[model samples]
Target chain A: MLLIRAIVRPEKKDEVLAELSSAGFNAATMVDVVGRGKQKGIRIGGMVYDEIPKTLILMVIPDDAKETVITMILSIAKTGTGGTFGDGKIFVSPVDEVYTISKGTAGL
Target chain B: MKEIMAVVRMKKTGATKKALVAAGVAGFTAVKVMGRGNLVTDPKAIEACKEKLLSMGMDEFSESWDTEKMVTSFLDGSRFFPRRLFTILVHDDDVPRVIEAIVTANKTEYGIGDGTIFVLPVSDAVRVRTGEAGEAAIW
Candidate 1:
């Protein structure tokens, strides 16, 4: 299985989540975080630079589903008026195993 | 607060549940999540993306008004998607040992792996039922 990690714009979070759910790919983890990039953060009219507030969403998908999930995330998190900075990002890694508690199921 | 606490994953959700139970977490909170590491900065690019979304009929205003509803609706319906998360309130001291257990058991390398563990400094906590405080906050 592949574990997907995405950092996205807080504003567009709903769109991404909704799209993912509608696509039938729910089940993931999320948190709020602070980070800076090469642009070194952001600058407004009067402000200099500062760290950004981002929401980190994580999930594990079957290996065969990587491309589809990636595409969905990108489509939902594209930058702009629709998705601002930190719209969303995805990271895929190997998930050796997964176990959901309410129902005792192993692997995907 | 006990000395050892952990968040573990197993092929058998039963095992993971058993582990958490054995670890002694009273209750846990989790939210669905997703992400990509690649980030960028370009006004034109951002604008174009917004235009594309607009064309698709994703009304920004409606989403802004009610994101929780949107997220739940989307996640419940999607498939073959991204990562999942679980946040457990454990005895703070257990953080290190639990990390050890998960890494060794999962066979993940340092700074690289299928999954990771992160720690956050607990500022303060509260008990919803009685409005308790401090260590009492954890229970």
Candidate 2:
């Protein structure tokens, strides 16, 4: 299994989630977080707000399904032509084990 | 690549960020989280509970009642404390530097709830805009 963590703008969270659900990858955990990327947060007026609100979406999928899920998220989360800063980045990690708490069954 | 996750005191987030930047880290993600360490009966923990109860209209108990006992009873109900979890991804060579920076900024003389640093192995990373992967994507 692979764990995909996508940090996207709050405005695009719903769209990304909906897209993933439509694609049959429904199980996901979303957390509201504050972070920054290469842009190092945005500056408005005379102040620099270093912490930007974002939605972190986490999902665990079969290894083979990684590309499809990532593509779906990227397509839905990107902003404007060629994408702008804060469009978000995705990190993929290996998941050694998964268990269904209610069913008492293992694997996803 | 490695993912360095550091859970530090809420008040030390600013110092941690500055330390990471000074250590040459480009970007990071931070989330507000609530967690508890092994020291369940720490005095500071009990004091925090008392303060919380007093703030929530339990001032009557503060003067006449055994506040410590009340706080200790409440401890079983609420043991978690607020913390900041910083998730930073850095190249393999930079792991030690990042770890050092986080520790330097968060460590205190008390040494109990200084927080934890976890270094996890990242399989891959992707930059959504340019379709880059691996090291090319992580910069």
**Candidate with maximal DockQ:** 1
CA lDDT, candidate 1, residue B63:
62
> Where does candidate 2 stray beyond 4 Å?
A1-108, B40-66, B70-78
Report the TM-score of candidate 2, chain B only: 0.77
Cα-based lDDT at residue B128, candidate 2: 98
For B56-129, candidate 1 gives per-residue lDDT tens digits of 54565666426444443333223223433456555666654444444444432211113334443455677988
Best by TM-score: 2
Task: Give a tens-digit lDDT track for model 2, residues B1-139.
Answer: 9887666778999999999999999699998865443334456745664677756645554653566565654453234467787888889899777777777777765445566665668889999999999987778
DockQ of each: 0.06, 0.04
Error of 1 at A26 (Å): 1.3
Q: Candidate 2's residue-wise lDDT over A7-99, tens digit each?
A: 999999888876776677765656678887787678899888889888887677889999999999889899998998988999998754444
Residue A14: error of model 1 in Å?
0.5
Candidate 1 on A1-108: residue-level lDDT in tens?
766888887777778777776666655555677787656678788785666888777666777888988988888788765755545457665644354322223433
Docking class of predicted structure 2? incorrect
Q: Report the Cα lDDT for residue B88, model 2.
A: 88
